[model samples]
Target: MTQAKATSGFLDQVCWNSDGLVPAIAQDFNTGQVLMLAWMNRESLALTASEGYAVYWSRSRKSLWRKGESSGFQQRVHEMRLDCDGDTVLLLVEQQGGIACHTGRSSCFYQRFSDGGWQVNLPVIQDPEAIYK
Candidate 1:
């Protein structure tokens, strides 16, 4: 079958939220470390499937965000899966540049809950200022 046909079938199964958005999680393909969580609209998800990379809906900007378009931290997807309820997407990817979080951390989930508070347990892999600019 054509790629479009395959993608269409997959997209039909996703249970998008009221805003027509679904939560997408990016995880390390090898280590299974969750890198970040983003949202995807139909267009972004379709683009991701066709392009073989990560594309997310930028809620703040109200636009499609091609991952690594600026910071060069692209996510090359190895596999994509839907949750049991079909409301979430999981992308197993090879994160480029070793940074997944905009803050330059390897993963966005760097804060750990401990001692009745949240603690930063991971060092920044690179300076955000340097990465963005």
Candidate 2:
């Protein structure tokens, strides 16, 4: 998070899946908000540590994606953590522009399960079209 270099073999220490990816969760450091969930390959995780930003492996695109590269709302890494099993990664970050979800909401986890139904709990801070374009 401090632009510290990821040690060699550090990526290997993570328990990678058969697909060579790990589940990554990004949280707002200041507000304790769960910003988003993503996937990170070795290279993306390494790059994220070295670059001090959120970089994820896009399963759909089959490529690495730097978060907010186009939306101008990059996540600055404040801390990186691994679950006890070492299969999941948690990143405490300062979210730029207060937007994390591609849908332009504060977080990807905008749904609440209540009354035996799923309800939207968060409002979109900005429209996707407005953010992406």
Candidate 3:
């Protein structure tokens, strides 16, 4: 089958929201740690599958976001899976530069609920200023 045909078939299995978006979760391939969560539209999902990387639809910017386009922390997807309900996507990826979070942490879920409030449990892997600039 053609690449476009295959992509369309796969996309057809997903149940996208009214905005044509599905929640995508990026996870560490080896460690099984969730790195980040983003949203993807059909175009972004097809691009990600074809490009073998993470591509997301930025609701805020109303555009396609190529992961690591500016930060140089691209996620090389090892595998992709859809949830049973077909509402979410899981990407097992090798996080480049050992960093996934924009805050310079290994993962975006760095905050832990403490006894009273949220607390930072993970240290920043690198300075965000250096990573972005």
Candidate 4:
């Protein structure tokens, strides 16, 4: 679907969990492909909307983070969605500048387990240094 069609939905009804957070999944809008998943509290959500970028709550680091703050491969928010349960969220983004994966791959989903071994599915699309400082 076009971004304009995808963006017409409301973001106010999205249900935040008890901790005031929602699980946000970042997907490639054109391909309907998932790229990454993260959490966002009310502040982060608001920040994302106001800033026109994706802001996430880091469970591991217990902090707020803008995807690619250091890498410069930011995900610009094209549209945001709430699932039927209201517990999950979806973000359609225009990924800027470079690969989203820190491992030098275009995306994080680069591995597939085969019959007896692990296989790399996609190639690293861009060098991290070209975008990251």
For model 3, how does the per-residue alpha-carbon lDDT over 1-133 read when each residue is reduced to its tens digit?
Answer: 0223344789999999999999999999999999999999999999888878899999999999998999999999888899999999999999999999999999999999999999999999899999888
Which regions in candidate 2 have their CA more than 4 angstroms from the true location? none
- Error in Å for residue 22 of model 1: 0.3
RMSD of each: 2.1, 0.8, 2.5, 4.3
List the candidate 3 regions with Cα displacement exceeding 4 Å.
1-5
Tell me each candidate's TM-score: 0.95, 0.97, 0.94, 0.77
lDDT at position 63, candidate 4: 94
Ranking by TM-score: 2, 1, 3, 4
- Candidate 4 per-residue lDDT, tens place, 2-62, comes to 2332231345677877877789888876666677778998778777877778989988888
TM-score of 1: 0.95
Candidate topping lDDT: 2
Can you write out model 2's per-residue Cα lDDT over 23-118, one digit (the tens) per residue?
Answer: 999999999999999999999999998999999999999999999899999999999999999999999999999999998899999999999999
Worst 10 residues of 2 by lDDT: 1-10
**lDDT value, residue 101 of candidate 4:** 77
Candidate 4 ranges with C-alpha deviation above 4 Å: 1-12, 116-118, 126-133
